[model samples]
Target: MSANASANSFQALVRLLRYARGYRRRIVAATTCSVINKIFDIAPEILIGVAIDVVVNQEHSFVARIGFTTPQEQIVVLAVLTFFIWAGESIFEYLYKILWRNLAQRLQADMRLDTYEHAQRLDMAYFESKSSGQLVATMNDDVNQLERFLDGGANSLIQVGVTVVAVGAVFFVISPLIALLAFTPIPLIIWGAFFFQRKAGPLYADVREKVGDLASRLSNNLSGIATIKSFTSEAREAERLRSVSEAYVEANRRAIQVSSAFIPVIRMAILAGFLATFTVGGMLALRGDLNVGAYGVLVFLTQRLLWPLTGLAEVIDLFERAMASTRRILDLLAVPVTVKDNEGKPLAEPVRGEVSFDAVSFRYAASGVGVESVSLHVPAGNTLALVGATGSGKSTLMKLLLRFYDPQAGRVCIDGQPIGEVSLASLRQAIGLVSQDVYLFEGSIRDNIAYGRPEASEAEVIEAARTAEAWEFIQALPQGLDTAVGERGVRLSGGQRQRLSLARALLKDPPILVLDEATSAVDNETEAAIQRSLAKIGHGRTVIMIAHRLSTIVHADEIVVIDGGRVAEQGTHAGLLEKGGRYAAQWRVQTGAMEESEALG
Candidate 1:
């Protein structure tokens, strides 16, 4: 590898080790087994040399010097020793496999879970900038890449190191000249491995990126399948997916070309080392300069030493891929959380739900379209409605209150306490939000309703569903509340999904409830049902509603008309109508349009 890239891979590995510090004891245990297993594995080669000595030297054998005088006795001794060596190898081999594989499973699961939790805590802006498929790829694919390396590659590397060191020591003690010549090609092999590593490093990284892109394309397509079918763009989407898939394949092909050449290069280098030991060691034994048993040891050990080096190509390939994945995974873990929870105090008990947006201003980093110095307040038990055209920053105000994106200027408070000074858990728990884009999990209606309060009783879930005017339709289904919602509630109608979302929020029973276009998806009858429910539901809790439909908020205690991220007007429904401004203009258009439809009917 180039010094710079090698250093980066090394740094990435170091970072991974630091992150895995919790598993240090398990790592040490696994590595100890690997090293001990290699020792026992190499012992059999030594035993073969000793058995050769017993056959040729008899009484003059090395074992005879150690007090076993007969060749038969020494042979039996070697047989028994071989059995134990092989047994030890088997035992430790099993041990290390269990240790390393279990470690990989546990570490990968923990890393994925930790990464997901951290991602959840990140600000909404971060999610807006990233694709869901890319995040899933990192959490699943990249983490699995690391697990595959740990499962086998790590043990291979450790055993290779042991083979080189243990065999090299034996070679030097037997005949330094043979050892020098036999070891000559090792430097070349090492250099070539690193050289290919440098080339493969960047290519593997590109392969990973291309895989992420492919994942993103797939995720986007699957999620929008209905849209593609409706628009008859299935063929176009298939072509797009094919393009991304081809890009991933091409990247893999490039990486394979470089990694595949390493094995052949290493094999030639190993050949040089093997031939040197064979020729020179045979010459030495013929000249009586080397003991026969030791010379035999050198011949066998030469292959044992150099053959493992050839496998370095595969090990290095695995290492490079792992390091690439590690860098991406750790880089995600290192992303600074801009919206930190400061571990601040919780909100006061019996949260009165008095909410205020004090001169709040926020601009989207990419679009620069957000609220501009907007401010408003809603007293406890009061309903305040936000009216605006689409993209007029109505929902941005609600997001600020929820701390999804902190305002660039000013503060949002509940119960006269600034939200930024409170713990995120406490602040969020105080409010329940049902957004314009309703989302339902792929589960039963009851499960979705009780999601925010899973411990809630069945009676409680039923009441929340009833309050959202969803219980009637839910009862009509064959499975009733147990009916599957399907993925993102695709099985349900838009209005049904909307009601379920409202039911979920109501189940939470937060002190403050925020509904952003909660009834936008419903038919007129369902809308009237929800309106009547809201009249009763708002009796004890604060309600903040953002609506495009003027009729929905006609009875709100106060209505604030937002225009271009600023408050254009604010008053009670009757008062705003008398002012004949923005609110009045919007009301007339909506009501007049409704009246014409009624007359036509």
Candidate 2:
């Protein structure tokens, strides 16, 4: 397992490069420009050497052999060459910079979208076990960090590689003895880089993990700010967040402390090469074994070769950070989707909403809280209400029917076909869900209602709002349907949010509708209003209602009373009241003229 984990970490960047294969041509073009630019950038030192040769050698200089007889003409020709070289270098620099940065932006955007699409495909239980903030970090923060590296560090790496190779060639051609001394420090510098890489790899991965935890904490605090304010727990929440942020800072500090020491140590090693080139090349020139101009080139080129190694610290740091983030992003992509549609079976054509639970059972992996040995059926175009005290698994049963969590035992089928064998898209499309916890995106009211059907016409949106009994309240808002609803519909009252949630579901116009405690949080008047709306649209669609209020479901075609994850009674409300069982006891208490007793016997 340890070996496998090590292999996985090492392959993170390799996998990213494989992903880049789609844009290989762009990368190649950008990299070619970078290489050509560096070559021209290195030419200035050689130009200086040729200029030195023209001055010292005078008429018999290397320039004279190229047909320039006088020093003045040679100088002019040299200046022209210099102008074009610098221009060519600047041109390629511009091209590479633009190409690389734009490529980063495009790739980052695409990767984020693909990652989110994959996240949506995952089973509901996976999301339950994960935090939204951590997912956001993976999709946003980590991806942004990689884009930053691409914007600058990518060029630094390519140019530095070019400098090393080009400069080393010049050093050797001048004098092997001087070249050997100049080349001595390079191997040590490379070895140090690899050593730093080994140590910093795990530290950076931990840094990424720490930031994810911090993001999760921040997200939790922001979402619950209202609750925190009401409870006056600002100080406590802030301290909790401080503790998480401090941990993140400490993790980064450790990684920074290690990577920080890299530059100074590399500089010490670089001193060896620079001084040796300066001293040895001078001696070779004085001994008449090498020309003064060649010696000048060697001295200048040696610093060019070695000084950039100081920036090796930064490039290595960027590489490590990118690799760490890549692993996280890839790990999310690597997660096997446990729940998926089976091939060869589509939702039966002309889906009629006949949902059945044939002795189905399931339990939460973390809490072991779920329904067990439950069996019920909602026939086409009928209403079935589920009622029980809280935590009685009523909602869990509905989740199972929706295939949010498949039952561990038995089968859940729609229209006599197992849902697992049906295409997930078609099956889910045929069902519309509206729960008590209504979530609205930060957009106009019309957008929220048409979320499931983006192509829904404006008239259709208003019609659905009217059917949901939300049109009157919506018209009172300043912008009507165009009014922006704040995040999670925080700008709207509880009833308004619930009504909009209903409108969203109604707009889907599905054959099956599941209202899981949809009206539980609303006032009596709003609940009545929603009830009237439900009654109107309840026909022509199979409705599964989970409600705490007995009055709402009293007219249901059937009522199922759940107790401890199992059905204790299943009958019409009138029949259950006549039998004087658990449902009857609850009904009596809710309608009692005396002091309230137990809620559900």
Candidate 3:
């Protein structure tokens, strides 16, 4: 990796460690267990040295210095202490495992939930720019990577530090000379571990990015498989996917190259430390400055302390990868929601569905291009139709009214109250919407209909379906209301999906209704049935309908023709035709279709 990439990885680690603030207690407990375990594990080496002294020096051994006086009894004491040390090591190992694993699981669950909740609260504009698979990869795959690291690598890292500190103290007390020799290589080992991390971290991060891209491509392709096959573009898509896969593989391989070199380099450092300690300590024993047993213990302890350092590279690698994922997860959680509830008095009474937009303007975040000042009104118990060519800001108007994106200028009002001053939940509750691009969850027909009103009774659901003119087709299904609608309602026809969307709105029964090209995809027969249902539902309710089909809105109580984001004309259908303007031109084209239908009839 380049120097900039290495620096970025370090910054990512710093950001990630900040998220563990909430897990401080667990981390402390786990670290304590790891330290205690290493302390106990170092005791066995001391015992081995004691056995050597008992056999060689007998009563004059160092065991006599502790008042054991007899070699046989000293052996017994050493045996019991060895058992206790091993047992204590085992107990702390268990404690560390339990604590670290629980911590890992808890952090994973909390982070995933928080990320998902934050994503939900974000503005719709953010979702428009992001892919579902990329978000899923962050929430699942990246989080799982962190959890796997915490499950073992965290404890290993803590234990390695404990080993170095505790064993270093022992070696110093025994013989500072040999301790210096053994400790000489530790700095080099640590430096090598860090050097490897600096190289591998960016490679792992790139690997993760490549995986996210691959997931996005797979998800998009699968969702559009029908179109791909229709156009015979399967081979092209496969080749594209292969290229992405190869990029991911190559990134991982680069990381492996650096990671694979870590252990061998670390092993050489350990060898240097080991040989220095062994040769020097043995020569000193021969010079009568150190006893045979003491020399034995020093050799065994040096190996016990330094051998584990060889595995430090692997643990650091895990840490680096986990830190990369953690940074992404934290960044997601840190994204502030631009759209939030306003602090205002709650509505005491139900809304009357009076909607008014006073010179509202909006621009998408990506392009900074938007509609200019525009205004319209729909009083209670009235219907308003918006007709325009594409890009004339028809849909943007609906989004502003719904508070999906607040307008940069002017105000949107509901029942005489500016929507910006009202709680978002209560404001949305007062309105119902049905769009042409209908979405249905993977569930039974009844569930899809009752989605907006989950607590609605079965009878109420059935009644709503009947009002939407969907009950006839629903009852014809294999399981009546219980029939499964596959993912996004794929099992249902386009017309059926529209009816289900209408049923959902009827169930909501909000005083304000929006139909944005709701009947655009259905056949003439289905459209006629839906139009009849809309007529019944629109009575005494405020309705705003946007449509390219002029016939759908010719009977609306009032029509507002939008051109270039401004209201160009406002009148009933007949008034517009008499005026011989844009509305009339659109009406002429639609009426031509009607004339052809009549001739066929």
> Could you arrange the candidates by lDDT from highest to lowest?
1, 2, 3
Residues 207-276 of candidate 1 have per-residue lDDT tens digits of 8898789999999999999999999999999999999999999999999999999989889889998898
What's the residue-level lDDT of 181 in candidate 3? 98
Model 2 C-alpha lDDT per residue in residues 161-236, reported as the tens digit of each score: 9999998888777788988999899999998877777777888888999889999999999999999999999999
What overall lDDT goes with each candidate model? Answer: 0.91, 0.90, 0.88
Cα misplacement distance, residue 172 of candidate 1 (Å): 0.7
Candidate 3 stretches with Cα past 4 Å from truth are 1-10, 343-345, 597-601
User: Local error of candidate 1 at 432, Å?
Assistant: 1.3
TM-score of each: 0.98, 0.94, 0.96
Q: Which stretches of candidate 2 lie over 4 Å from their true place?
A: 1-9, 66-69, 342-346, 593-601
The alpha-carbon lDDT assigned to residue 43 of candidate 3 equals: 88
Candidates 2 and 3 compared by lDDT, better number: 2
lDDT of 3 at 287: 96
Q: What C-alpha root-mean-square deviation, in Å, does candidate 3 show against the real structure?
A: 1.8
